[model samples]
Target: MSMGTQGAGAGLTRPAPATRAALLVLLVGAACLLLGPRLPWLVEWPAGWTVPATDWVGAALEWLLGGIKPVARGFSEMLRYPMDWADAALAVTPWPLVIGLVTALGWAIGGAPMAALGAVGLGFVLASGYWVQSMNTLALVAVSVPLALVLGMGIGILANEVPRLRGPVQVLLDVMQTVPTFAYLTPLLLLFGFGPVVGLIASAIYAAPPMARNVLLGLERVDSQIKEAAIMSGGSRLQQLFQVEIPSAGTQIMVGVNQCLMAALSMVIIAAVIGGFDDIGWEVLLTMRKAQFGQSLLAGLVIVAFAVIIDRMSAALASERNRQDQRVTAGLVLLAVAVTALFWRSLPDPAGFTLLAPVAEAVDRGLGAFTAANGATLDAIKNGAMFYGLLPLRIGLDDAVLEFTWGFQWTPAMSLALYALAAAGGLVLAFAGRATAGALLVIAVGILETGVANLAWPFVLTGAAALAWLAQGRKLALIVTLLLLTILLSGLFPRALLSLYLSGAAVFACALFGGAIGLVCAVSPLAWRMMRPICDMLQTIPLFVFLIPVLMFFQIGEFSAFLAICAYAIVPMIRYTRHGLVSTPTEMLEAATASGATAWQTMRDVRAPYAAPTILLGLNQTILYAFAMLVIAALIGTTGLGQSIYLALGQADVGLGISAGAAMAILALIADRLVQGFAEERRRALGL
Candidate 1:
């Protein structure tokens, strides 16, 4: 009786942690809001607070570069050597030989149909009077793809073993993958200066992470059954890893390489923006700037064609059937292309080729008329977005956040109280398992603290790192913190929130449309067969390509941005969900069937739970994809951190650009962590 009474008394005295946390958050938030308005200093970032940290970073980079100037030059020169050789060689190389070479590669890798497409694509570029430029882009991709794959493999291999580093590495990769191409110029400029080398360096850096990530995933997924068999056969660690694990993981690695190839090609244009290689990317940008829609469309189509050819070939090579046989043939074809590219100067041109010139022109003309025909409709759509969506979103979210952070009107004591309250709230969140929220709250408090708050950022970062180490055993809390910090510092926290507000709506939209399509197709094998190729094709098309038509139809507004993001990011959602459903273990389905479950019940109870992680992965990819396009869509008037990055890049303001990059990175990380965390937990419970 005494023990029971004591237990009851203890239970009454100690409330649930979640309940306590919620109560504290509510009380603190209420107090801050009520008193915060009166406290100017507490509400807004005060003046005279600044960090020369960027300058320090620049200096450090300069010092490092200067120390390795000689080696840097050598590396730069070595990379340029092949590019220069290809340019000169292609200028004189016979069109027939060039066409035949690509055709052979396509034939060897993907069979006759792909070979024919390759021929058409190569011939079209040659005849269109852009052979030289096309070749330049091609060579860049050829070289960069291999380098990225190799480097990615090396790094992924090393990183996978360092358990503590895995989280931080992933955070870095996620950030890098989505960062705007222009932002990288800051670091590359410091290292390689301006030229094709700059583009090469940037392309490799940008493309490697995906390959690395895929490599890691591939290795982790290698079947323990196969590995154990190798061990029983007395295979050494290195032998088993090389002869067994690597071979088994070929498909994933190939997927990474294919993505790397596409990314490298996409960056060619961006790199040209800042004096890299003179290729299709530059021409595409130039024609667009001149408003020559037909010509720009032509160039864009050519890029798409090239992307298609590469994607198809890579996919065929990675397929289960004839994998070993395909490898040797593919290798030979690639070697032939590279070797032929080397002798470009020796081979005479077949006097102004006869291939895609006419087709390209017709397509260009058709696209021009298409856009023109819809001009009125597009204009109306644009107006609707700007007036209806953009303005309201900006005013309600952006203005509201900024106003609170700025302390629009408040007395000195009120400001101090508001600042103190924000600090306390942030502190509580930090300790209460919502590190992201805590960091944002504290940063708000520090902004209110202004001059001194700027200095406090370092400590905030330290605290986040320390806290992460304590809680998660050294994942990437610092990077997660920095991401939010960047958004705050870039003066875009308000806009960033608004960006998320829009992205959230967009994601929900994708969930509905994409999820429906995927689920419907998954239920029918024949429908899945048809849709799978279509999805794969759509996945190959770059986000920028989607923007051209979206901008035309939507007429350059927030809605255009939203539409583009949806189309670009929705593929992953549909693809992942369908793949998960289709790939569900047969045994589970049988068990559910044995239990007298209907199809829907099996999906909900058996397949859905089994496939949740994959679907969540799709969700994660969708968010990242949406954010990736966020910067590009800014050109159409989407207001947010993306716009800030664009403006900063234009002004050459490194600090502003980096901050925006960091903010976007954190936003992505937060969404990723949320979905990934839940998915991981579910998978663990399901023993998957």
Candidate 2:
């Protein structure tokens, strides 16, 4: 009893690091945000402050590529074996037989409905006379997916096994995922030049990061008890991983495969743009270029069809209970379908029959009908959007920024002075026993040294501090501060800031609309059931495809690009909002109701707060999707970092592309960090 009391007493006497850190940094951060801008040098990086950082990265990539060329060639040659095999097997096979095989496989995986959908999709492609082109796409996928799976799986395992490397690897993955897919073409073409293999390599690279992330998540999320049990059983390290962790992670890893497949499909068209894949993407491009809107629209649908079938199968493979059953059903269904097809083998030749003519006519007519019916209203909306919405929006944006920062042209001396102020603040905090807070100030100073601090540093610092304070996330505030500061010297800070504000606006707009749908879904079962699939379909459409409908309605401009971003990004907001609200614990709601709360009151007090964290995650996805579409939006001519990438691509300047892409990534990471910080705080409050 005496010792226990002593221990408690000692614990009570110990100082809280977080409290000290928060208080110290808060005072210094505020000073920096307020007075530092007036003293321009105080917030800028030091004179001639080049970091000598990027040279190493370029050298590393060059060295790695040079060193691996022979090995890549040998390994890639081996991978071509599967492509060759699939090619030969399907080469002489009738279109009906191929369609039958895929339909049966889909049925085996997801049952009759999915099978029928697969059959329709495959048959439509054949009937549209695009079977050969799609087959070529498949051959590309067949080779790329396997190679990506192996590399992704291996990298994921390595990340899991080595704790020290995980952060760096994950950072790399995050950057890789955020980089515009078009940007990858720069480095890849420089190495492999223009060939199927180059496209194959690029697609594989794009697909691998998602897979690695999923695998890493799968491994990390495994039950600690299960791992302990494996250890107790005297299993070897390899055996424990293979037998326990890998199996447990199976569902998530397979989900990664599903994502990887979709990413590959998305890239197939884009890859074709870069002279890589010459399949359906090429067909769609050629048609679209020639103003063959009907054929182009049909071709785009063909790509979506392929995506749906592959995604369904991959999802079914990921679910443990259905895996075995699917295989069994697939075999039997395929056999029957093959037999049935043999009876009407003559239908395989599209030259004689016009199976898709009706579909083409319907699409063409439907598009015309929509335009004819709504032309005047659409015109009003378009003009209003162009002049009132877009033009006026940017006009007010720079005005909304702090008056002090607008004409701020900072110098090296001013930047060094800001570091001095920060140092002084840290010293005071440290002397007051707030070492962690002081440490953050020191880190923030380092960020200032990098020279990016001059671009909206006051607003950025204020925003971070406020959010961190709201979340009780002092540590995150420091980390995010350092991250934003590191890019200060890049000359991209203003553009990145512009991109973020645009994304923020789009996300806000999406949340308003998405939240309404989510609220309806929350209250009604039928609405939930109907809206879920619509959201899924919205998400499955590729990045640029979102632009097609937007361009058709609004024409190419800021409004059009913003609309495209919203259309593509809103699905996550809708999905996550619905899920978060619907999945709220029934007991919590009951308790709220019992506390003399009305239905609306209970929802506001209980469900909404609990759901906020999840909705934020959805918002995070929305932001990322917005950025992805934001980059693609450059195709229609818009301003910001994405437009920078567009201009850079035009000059074939790989360095500029990389810099602009990295700046966008930095912007994304900042948003991601803020959301994560708040989510953690929410969970802690709930004690979850």
Candidate 3:
């Protein structure tokens, strides 16, 4: 039987057994939650008498190396030696010759524009006196990215081969990706002892998951016919993977590589806090600490430059790889070897080049003057804004929400009614075709178990009103309704309120801003051109680097925190918007123009409607990004689930953290499901 038939048969046989299993699971979960506090015996803990071998080994190494300082010093020296050589080579080599070589290498691997962009970014770094640090950063990325790619690919292949392992592997990857960067630092520090190695290892771990997931997705998407053909030819698993699967999934795998590279670069900057290395990240940290605003900004620019170069190079490589006929592997190899040889031959002494010091000093002076001039004014503004503006706004909003929910008779009932309405809507939507009875039963159980049945009448009316208003192009009305509903629900249950409002606001704001920027960039060719590199930099530059600057400028508040959230969230919006707009059929555009439609009219009436599904997908991404940033934003201080999660990490409260994280995941799932439903409807309507 066909897979579809098998699936149908399984579905027919599944519901009763699955329902029973689910009930049992819920009972077990309830038991655990209720008795967990009193069941000391159920908790697992390491014996106090037991010694960890890794810790012992680390201690012995620490003793032999005379502690972390000497070990760090030795590692630094080892890495620095090559850097010194590169600096010497840079000094001796004529700028033109080096530029030419870099350009040539780029052209060989990618093309002329990529080579040109690479040269410009490199030259900019050199002139800005950040060449050495940039190179050091590059070296670490160079090592880590490939390692991540290889490891990710291996895992991805295994996941594809072993069908049973897929779900578990995906879950593990999700956890790895979501867990705070700081939480992993302690364990990594214990193992790698704080240096480039630790940073590289951490970056690799952070970067690999997406690649593995993407690779698996790509592999799974390959045509069954192609696989069958390969199998019929008596191809072994390894041979089929190499000859058919990899080749067919080449473009997707390359995309995974690009993601890996971007992820690694981002992590490398964050790793600086754990004493990764004396690269651009270290410089930015140092500059910030010393109140060297100009220096910090300049360091940020250099980092941005490095990010841009790597992003462009990888994108170009991916593109080149996509066009397999144009790729000249032999030529690239020759060019790389020649450049390396020439660079080595023209090496200079370390003492001769004091290029970076002058730049650093100048930055210090400029920053000092700026700070001195604006110190009091800036401080006063910052304090006033935080105290009078933000504090009052947040407090009033929270108070108003609380009062409205508690003081009003109808509001609480309305909120409960909305929940029931949503549940009913979900059941109707999900089961309208064939599984109506099962869906209704599931919804009934969910409502009853959750004690939402009491509020069902109010929730149904309120939710229906809200959703109806939304369907009629009344977004603001919908938003207001949602906010009110959230407030009332939160008042009823503060914990639930915290999770809903904070997560909802973050996602909404992120999608709004990201979508707006993306729309602008997508429409304007010049803006799109300018934004490409900036977007590339944003994508590749470490999240920590972005966080540092925002923290420095705005300090810790909802405003600063939101700004950081928006920065990361905006990427997909721009990317998807641009993609959607560009992918709109040229023939349609011409036809619209021929029909005497203005550009704005064409875009509004044709392009936008056509692109709605893709744009919605971007919004979905924005939600994910916003949710991800919520956890990260805790670093800058905010009291919510994120803060709780961070505190849990600090105290090694894994259970608490996991529970909170699950709550976050549920919020994410709700958004995902809602957006996915909308996207699916749009696609069907559009015949996509």
Estimate TM-scores for all models.
0.75, 0.78, 0.63
Clashes of 1: 8
Error of 1 at 320 (Å): 3.3
Model 2 TM: 0.78
Q: How do all the candidates rank in terms of lDDT, highest first? A: 2, 1, 3
Which candidate leads in TM-score? 2
Give the per-residue lDDT digits (tens) of candidate 2, residues 425-450: 87787677565567577655543343
- For candidate 1, the per-residue lDDT at 232 reads 93
How well is each residue in 352-471 modelled by candidate 1, as lDDT tens digits? 553555665675577668769986776766655644444434443222333334445335565568667876886686566554465457544543333221222334344444434333
Winning candidate number (lDDT) = 2
Q: What residue pairs are clashing in model 2?
A: 41-414, 41-415, 42-414, 42-418, 44-415, 451-488, 451-489, 452-488, 452-489
Q: How well does candidate 1 score on lDDT at residue 163?
A: 76
Ranking by TM-score: 2, 1, 3
Report the error of model 1 at residue 59, Å. Answer: 4.5
lDDT of 3 by residue, 23-73 (tens): 343344344334545853222121442234333443554455455655555
For each candidate, C-alpha RMSD in Å? 8.4, 8.8, 12.0
